[model samples]
Target: MNALKINTFIGRQYDSNFPEVITDAVPITNPLAVDKAYNILEENEGDYLYGFVSLIYNDVVIFGEEQLTECLLDTWSTFSYLLESRYDGSKHHIIFLDNYPYINTTIQENGQYYEIQLDQYQCFLVPIEPFKKELKKEFFNFVEFCKNEKLWFSEESSYRGLLETYNEIKISK
Candidate 1:
């Protein structure tokens, strides 16, 4: 089994124009938890949803809190392309978030492993199959959650784009 693990949370920043009202992070354990988090954010009149995601390998934090400001759906949808890169013969994939406190994550394939770098500083190598397996599982789970909540129909363009890409990725896989 691969030692790589992915953890994520969803939270909101209310009153985003003036003073920000940051909500506590809600652990993304399942589809219901993500739905509940968004529902609560909507109820509280949040401007948007954002969150943190970490990649842990063998009990070490490869990517952590510095990346907390990413828009959850947008980041995940972009990150999903990493999986596609494996099959498309693309050597490297980078996920860059241009929001406040910018985040840049790069993943490059080397032989049977993928070397992942965060902000050009932190780096680690994870076996290709395991990394793909974990990422695909995490992404599909989020896609299922989006479908269950009808986000493609009710939410903004980001959600719609995510669903569209999800369908493409599913069909390609």
Candidate 2:
């Protein structure tokens, strides 16, 4: 069995010469940090919710950073494409991150599994069903979080489109 996990964090924007400086970060899973993180996201609406996301496989961090500045909405939007691709039977997909190093993760379907590669040296095989299950769960949970917080984008048509896509994927084989 392959162990795959996705964790997202909410981070505060800090003044810096470089755009990647985010501080006082906290995981979305942290109950106490939820409101505080939401406040930071609300205040920095123009900045697009500075955040971080990590992909862990079998206890190894495939990609992540404590200070990396990632736009929460955009990252989720990008990841949604993977679900679409998988549903459409696409053999190959690549997810490009929006921050430093500009690393792109590749996912290639091989039979009942996806071979995910972070780089030449880091690769893992995960069964397709579990990957979809975890991704969908996290995506929907984040959407619910945004809705409960009454985030501005939660009402946007684009965000609604994501919810629609998620529903479609959920009912499909």
Candidate 3:
């Protein structure tokens, strides 16, 4: 297999030179998709943590291999619309997913092409409020830490930094 670097799914051209962490981490399961992030979201339902986000280039995700069964079953229209509206002349767009956050990418090996899926929940670097209400302690702490630490990014940083921080927090915990 070609050595695709295993790091946060920042935009295609992103290199992690800034402070970031990962949260709501989990292991991937689905053979056809990355279900790790979804597993965490499901387990944390009624709690504070939520789903993962993918840093996409245009409509195509740059992470790993997976079937868009969930996306098609769930947010096909929303994603399509997002592509149509937000894709523009830009070659990339970061998708902020509150739920159903998973991806699959293709690989070549042994004279054949294959797909490997990973749970993207391991991709998020911060805890997010599950509901649109006052922030919880963990959420507040993570946000405050981001602010004080100057971890926030202006252009493509939000997606990458938040996802990176999520991983850091997960490892520390």
Candidate 1 residue spans exceeding 4 A from truth = 12-22, 30-36, 39-48, 85-102, 152-156
lDDT of 2 by residue, 1-173 (tens): 47888777766545466567645667776874567656765675534566666777777776566325546666676566777744454544343335534455567677987777656567777777887788777887776776676656434325666667667766774
Indicate which candidate wins on TM-score: 1
TM-scores, each model vs. reference: 0.73, 0.72, 0.19
Candidate 3 stretches with Cα past 4 Å from truth are 1-101, 104-135, 159-173
> Whose lDDT is higher: candidate 1's or candidate 3's?
1
Clashing residue pairs found in predicted model 2: none
- For all candidates, the clash counts are 0, 0, 27
Tell me the deviation in Å of residue 66 in model 1.
2.4
Better TM-score candidate (2, 3) = 2
- RMSD for each of the candidates: 3.9, 3.8, 18.2
Residues 42-160, candidate 3: write the lDDT tens digits.
Answer: 44341222222232322345443222222211222222222232333222222333324532221212112212223433322111111101112233333443345443233422334
CA lDDT scores, all candidates in order: 0.64, 0.64, 0.28
| Positional deviation of residue 39's Cα in model 3 after best superposition, in angstroms | 29
Better of 1 and 2 by TM-score: 1
Model 2 vs truth, CA RMSD: 3.8
TM-score of 2: 0.72
